[model samples]
Target: MATDTDFIHRVGDLAPALRSGGQRLHRPLLLLWALAQAVNGKPRQQPWSAIRASVTPLLATYAAAPGDQAAVYPFWALRNSNLWEVEGSEELSLTSDGRRPTLSVLNERDPLAGLLAEDHDLLRREPSVAARTASSVLLRFFPDVMVDLARDLDLTTLLAGGIDGALRPRVGEPYANRTAIAAVYGGNGVGGITPLADGILSVYSDDKGPYDDRRVAGMDWIAYTGDGLAGDQKMSGGNRSMSTYRAEQRPLRYWHKPHGGVFTFETWVVIVQCRQRWGVGQNREPRREYVWILAPVPSPLRATWPEEVKEALAQDVADDLKVHDDLDVDLPPVALGDPQGAMTDMERYRKLSAAARRTAAGRTDRSKLTKVERYVRSTAARQAVILRSGGRCENPTCLGHPTELTDKGDPLLEVDHVHELSRGGGDTPESMIALCPNCHTLKTRGSGRQQLRQALLVRAKALHRSFAGSQGEDEKRREPTTGQPL
Candidate 1:
């Protein structure tokens, strides 16, 4: 429904409204430089020096006099016209008059952020759009001067998509464009481009950039304490209590990278919503859904969670879920929470036997156990250990394969702690062992339990070695044997 005229008017209407000065060529020239950068495949934002270098030649050829031109003036003040936006400016010290900062301040702070990504896309998709915008600026402000300068810079073809039908440096003379863009792709600076085929790994060489490659299963699991380290903000659902902060669409900031010794950078994202889903028996367990909606706001800016609450109805999306987590319910219901009045006859006997495990030592202080303790006993970890063990008891001394599958289609095996919790053992995967009822009873109650424990430890270590050695091996070659009972 939109036409090219709408685009031209949008670009042309951004004339600055300076309080005292007459019309100036700064905004148009800045726009032209930005357009040129887009044509040449440069980043959206150019450094101030790049802007100065790129536009200086044009200004020198068209200025009224020798001392009447400055790049910083337009770069800093163009934001007033809504034609430009700058960040890293708040860090700069402002003058008393509250006017635009001096060139020195701008240079020191280097707040010359680039235009919006959408505008860059517009210029790229329709070179004629930029050409028309430039023509409008010249016709409106400096008809006479622009006439001569336009011709000298080959503006006719440049604005009209040139001989090759693109607004770029002439064919086979790529460096013919602006000096700053030349300096960038020409590989003259530290922030220059590198080819991946060279086998040199650099952050700049990576096409996905830093943030896009790092994916978390759920945003709710991520903690943004405003700290810079991933270890400082560990990813765990148990550690997070989202009840205090109701899930809603809101601004969220996450640590990016180290900017300096004292502070770090952050990427902003919107917490679209907090979602909850129940599996077959997941009602006893809580899990948060992490779905990223295409953000309605701009990127690389800080967004905060809203304190005020608003009600909104939920709508269904058709996209397939990429990842889903369901608690491992194959173990005895005791490992999960006790299901009131639902204990099977076999489970009742197991619970009575487990009660016999109680020594003079008091019951485990469950309240005092950290989330790390809970994670050791988590459904994910339990499933991982069992599946890796291949649906059989892991004791090395005896053969006790699962005779049947649980209701969840998992092998029926008892989960045993390699070291008893009362004996000061932590509930880690390495410390947890899967066993059949016979092996579990023998290891938990029979004589030579310490010897059996030693044998299970050896088998567990062998499994780890097999999994580790799986790298570079064929799938069939890497397949693990069905575990044996102790």
Candidate 2:
């Protein structure tokens, strides 16, 4: 029979011995052993059922010896039992136990523990474990990793395509692996190991300062071109093919070429068409407008183009100018700034002009305008009526708000007529007003909105008929149908 001293020694040796055996014990068994050692050699016996109830499911078993059997027989319980020890029980009680058994046992045997333990140790050592933990929690609940990555990819592609990096800020460093991971894992950042086989990875070096003269120092550069934007560069998944390239390194500068003209004149123009029908408020007219913009082409032009190509382009521009007096309205000017400079500038100018025009169009206050004055006035007046209607559909049941702002902060409010203009609804403030984009689209597409309206009207008519029928029945029951007060 084991003596009390021997039992104590055995209890002390259990964890180290188990660690040395190199046996991969099930976690539940390990926990039971730890808890058993924690309550070793007490006077009063712990109820087996209570112990089992406390640790069942998590621990495989819970057993204890009675009286002196406690010293000789090895007891078993849960690893969590070390959290408490029983009071008044001279033997072991969990209520008296302070340290949790699993942690304590693991700590004691740490030096001798094998591969599984090493893996746990590695997790503890990771610098990003805390951040990864928080990220894991968010990902677990809301799986939007791929959606976010797609958005990132779009922005990176735009920037790599010579779009303004400042205007299109990049997210975290574009990792080649992340793209493949996203693709294979349903864009949620999990599973799959196949490498992407077909894409181009472009690297962009962000200038540390506004001026190119200042070198990007030791700061870790932001990466924008990788698998995220270009898909898997190594794999051909039949998805969209993507490529990235660095923008022109030169700063924005205008290049001017002298034409045979007495005055050095440059001009820009913008023309926009409202693609959707149903103009401002009740008006169902498509608004079409254009603007003329001018800036002198810079003097002392330098071209990266081959001499022959440059000469050909210059001749082409000259020919076009001779054919059309208003170059701004007739053709897009040759971007003389650098490679792809003209296209980039034109796009930027278009966005800026659109924003300005939208603001001007929405304003209720009258302002001066050179051209398209009548059109602008009409747009503003219609917008004013739409705004006055609480910026929602006039229809009581149409739960649609009128104005919505775009990502770039432009208002996207549309005026919707209560009745279709084609059906003889005259263009008047009373006939039309503001409606949300969704409602306008629904109404235009001949979708369920019209059906829903018809259904509601039908339901209302039926309800009225039912009430009238009930009143007639009541009159018949109360008196002869010859009109008598009940």
Candidate 3:
């Protein structure tokens, strides 16, 4: 008899060890998928189609090679893992040894299956613990591919405490401050729409799209855009209503669409940086708006932001950074002028330099830069870098997939200096670009670092120019301009 903790440990310890001998990951992937669905509030007993809907993508992502048909191997084989069980599965033909079902059999039967009762209970009662434990296990066994796929799939919402994270306040705001912002906008805000009884966003509908169908075109990667291009027709690639929502500074609400079904985001994304954009509304009015970026809310802040989700996301960044930094290559070392220098610690040096300038000017009262002033100076540049990259790693190879989630359940990406900041590059978007940790570390510290930097700068600038031309030349609008944070 396993204790509850013991059971969970065993679940994590599961390896896809079929008697045929080669190590496989399908079991672990299936286990995590089952746990994720449990966290998402699906019923304890799930049909095979439900599992298929989820696991097929995992197979596509984590399979050793493209077009592998091994997804069904786990659907039947996981019964041995003890964390999973199947019901009504007799219709399928078993292997010659009678231990597992053939893939063809699974395809024909498509029977119902689910997590074991006790396993489901544990996951349901302690979703956070289960999510963290499972993620830790996956991270330990399948770090790079699993972590990246989890983010790209938006599967972190299970660990994210579901809708609770969306209800949380933004940085520097009181909890539930959305109510205040809603009041400010009156009927023009997210609250202006009839709230869902459960306050969760619903499915996408065809009525909402210029797209062709309402099929739940399962997303391979979540996409993000910056404030500067939020209104650009070709940039947003969305419909009029989405544009209207941004124009109003509104949090998203699930709504009807013409082609894509009733579409909705997984969470309530708040504005991080706002600016005026051209041709946003029905009348094509220019309006004040902000670009949305997903960032993990800082810790010590209390909101629906889950500690587990933050830890998992942070771990993903760490793992990605490690992969790039640990790449085996012999490259000439770039000398660090001060190996121990801390960027944050250098702020003190900046203040001292400012004080000396004030003294030389015959001014006695030297006020150091305030947090708000620093924020004002950097927000425009940050927004520009994020917008230019189209909310994905600017490394042309990584595509638009997010490698991690923000506290708000948005994509997490780091902004990097395309030109070395220490080498006198200005803190402007032109000098910076957005990158995932792996790509950033490679560009800054890996072999061929200078060539990579030059390449990225070229791509970043070209992307900016292309985005501007597509949006009727909104280039001048993205220039460093500051406004008070909302």
Candidate 4:
């Protein structure tokens, strides 16, 4: 008996015998048909003759090319996907390919075949699972004709919402430390928001940071402060990175710190709303910052998000979450900043470097050039790189990578130099960029180091210019210059 996880795992990862690529939908179509049938109370196992007659015409008309209704293979070969079973299999002779027998022998035998009982039972009990699975399959394989296919399969009720991956987090558990959290949700380990390889952030927060971030005493909402410390936070940088997750339909990996010990992975949260609140600057000047209101959710399956919270947040927007006054000392505003922020970390570094180039000089020692240079050993460039990354690695060609934690217990997104410092590369932001351990390894020691370095240089320059092209220009015209003091 396969468990729910097992059924879900197998169906999602089906390795159909795709040696014949002519009809790509054979196995998936067959599985969808079976799952829909399960929801409709169809018998789990049925005779092959009946199965053939039922699905042949549909496959021919809907899924297959002309005169290519090869329905026999899925019935026999689908067992290879581990979601089906053939009755009286002990007496059957197999083909040389070890997948299925000739269609003629199957016609004579008239064997019973269908979804395994355990799978069928689970599908019947949890129709949403069936719907979610069928919905995913249709979207993945038959997107163009999905609506018609769903109607044909009678999968309307079972598929109320599509199921993607669940937001990965063992909620309500104490993480050994923040580093463990970074390892789970890939990102740079330092900030409240970690950028995933997919260009989104996993926002981490606790009282540990400068901002007054915390959980509402009894509510499942987090009062998160947007990234920035002075001069009225702008809708740029980390704040912009975290705020867009809601519209992107992404879930946030929100981590909370309690006294900075054994960090707890608070929950998977959605950006409910953000409001401008008053805050204090490093120099005790009055400033406004973005405070994001995050509502906890069970998963990324949007259908499961708490509706009441949505209603409350929407209502809160109508009523306006009050701004926190700087003088209050205890109170602050809940700020939600820009869809795109004032400037990215890379931009900030460039501006800082440009401002200081007269006093500061680029490295001129070309005696010991190597493929990659060590970290600049400074926080200004490193912070800018990590903040710009928003926790994800910055390499454009990095299709995906493992989330590793650094010695500082942050996502081990190594702050490595794109150009060799030993060979006169400036130990500067333009010369340095954040990379995941895998990409860092490849850049440092891989055979294609030269090509990778050149590519990385392009990526670094692009990232550096990201903000100036949009927000920097905007900042020059409309916003004030605000960041850590030089």
lDDT of each prediction vs. the true structure?
0.43, 0.27, 0.45, 0.61
Positional deviation of 275 in candidate 2, in angstroms?
A: 21
Better of 2 and 4 by lDDT: 4
TM-score of each: 0.30, 0.18, 0.32, 0.40
Candidate 4's residue-wise lDDT over 1-486, tens digit each?
556545655765654343354436778888988987888988888888888887887787666633423887778778877889999987888778766777777888989888888889888887655665675566445645766787888876655443333222446666676677555544456666655322235676665556667554234467777887667787778876665554333566676776647677667777766656455554445477777767788864455677765664455456454332322221221111212256434445454444323222443432111110111113345545665566678887785563565332455587776876444444445556789978898998999998998888767756755734554344335322352111
Full ranking by lDDT: 4, 3, 1, 2
Candidate 1, 1-486: lDDT as tens digits: 334444443554564443333446666667666666776577888777677666677665564312323776677776665546777767766667777677677667666666666677777677666675555455344544554655654465555542222212111232222233324222112221111111111111111121111222212222112111122222233113221112222232222232222111123344323222111222323222222222212331122222211111022111122222221322333333234367643343233222222211243544311221232224333443564456677776655554455544446776666766545553434446778877888887889888888777666646544543432134235334554321
Which digits, one per residue and each the tens of the lDDT, describe model 2 over residues 228-277?
Answer: 22111231221111110011011111111122312111111011110111
Worst 10 residues of 4 by lDDT: 368-377
lDDT tens readout by residue for model 3, 1-486: 334455544654464453443347777777777777777777777766667766777676675523435566787878876777778666567889987777666667677788888778777787555655555445433544654666654566654543223232222332122334334211222321332221221112223222111111122111222223223333232323244333322344322332323222223332222222212222323322322222222321224435543443344345441211111111111111222245321232223223222222322321211211222224344544554554578788664445575443334677766775334343444456788877877886889788887788767656655544433134335433552110
Those runs of model 4 whose alpha carbons end farther than 4 Å from true positions after fitting are 17-23, 61-69, 96-98, 160-486
Which of the numbered candidates is closest to the native, going by highest TM-score?
4
Over 4 Å off in model 2, which ranges?
Answer: 1-375, 393-395, 399-404, 407-412, 419-425, 448-486
lDDT of 2: 0.27
Q: Sort the candidates on TM-score, descending order.
A: 4, 3, 1, 2
lDDT of 4 at 276: 63
